[model samples]
Target: MGHDKSGINNELFFGEKNAFSKKYEAILYNESKALSPSAKVYFNQINAFLAMKKGKADLAYTHMQRIRVLYSWYPEIKENNYNEYLRSNRNLCIVLMHQKRFEEATEVIDQLQKP
Candidate 1:
């Protein structure tokens, strides 16, 4: 899920309907109501990624950080799932970078590489 997602072309984000990130996002918000809290976390992930793309790093960070809360919403989420690690650290890096916290961003990038 490294963002340049040329494969998700049918999505309204790419073409003439570029304003569709918000449009599709409304759909995600509505769909989230039908999901379990566990499954609902994906909406935050999607919102975070879209915010990143739109250069709203702070908002992106908020959504990414929400995952921690969402994860703890159920014991089924586990202590530190690998995908959670990847997603959180990756988005945090983006936020840190935007804030000019290069040292902190580097540390997060380093942490993301940890075993």
Candidate 2:
């Protein structure tokens, strides 16, 4: 699925309802087996998107946190186009605000506003 302006897939990443989570988990697990850091990070973004779709705020936060960690260490990611990353970070902040985690959301927003 291609990213929309929100950095999430325009169409459902996995499927409708719980199907997305199931498919996402399966793909994430399979990709993790290859020990490719970049692949793992990308799949984690998918997982976050699925969680957000399902209204699983806590799970979404956790997945977004993982993405932040992955971003911190991956030099290749810095060299590549990071528009998706910025969009994803903004989306995560919105999710956190919806969940009433204002402090955490503010942190994300502040980071995003940085150069």
Candidate RMSDs in Å, in order, are 5.6, 6.0
lDDT of each: 0.67, 0.73
Residue-level lDDT tens digits of model 2 in 1-115: 5567889765555455345556445566654553776776777777677678667988878888887887888857745858867877887887789899889888887877787
Error of 2 at 55 (Å): 1.7
Clashing residue pairs for model 2: none
- Model 2 residue 78 CA deviation (Å) reads 2.9
Residue 77 in candidate 2 has what lDDT? 79
The candidate maximizing TM-score is: 2
Best by the lDDT measure: 2
Q: Candidate 1 clashing pairs? A: none
lDDT of 1 by residue, 1-43 (tens): 3235566654354443678655665666653563776556777
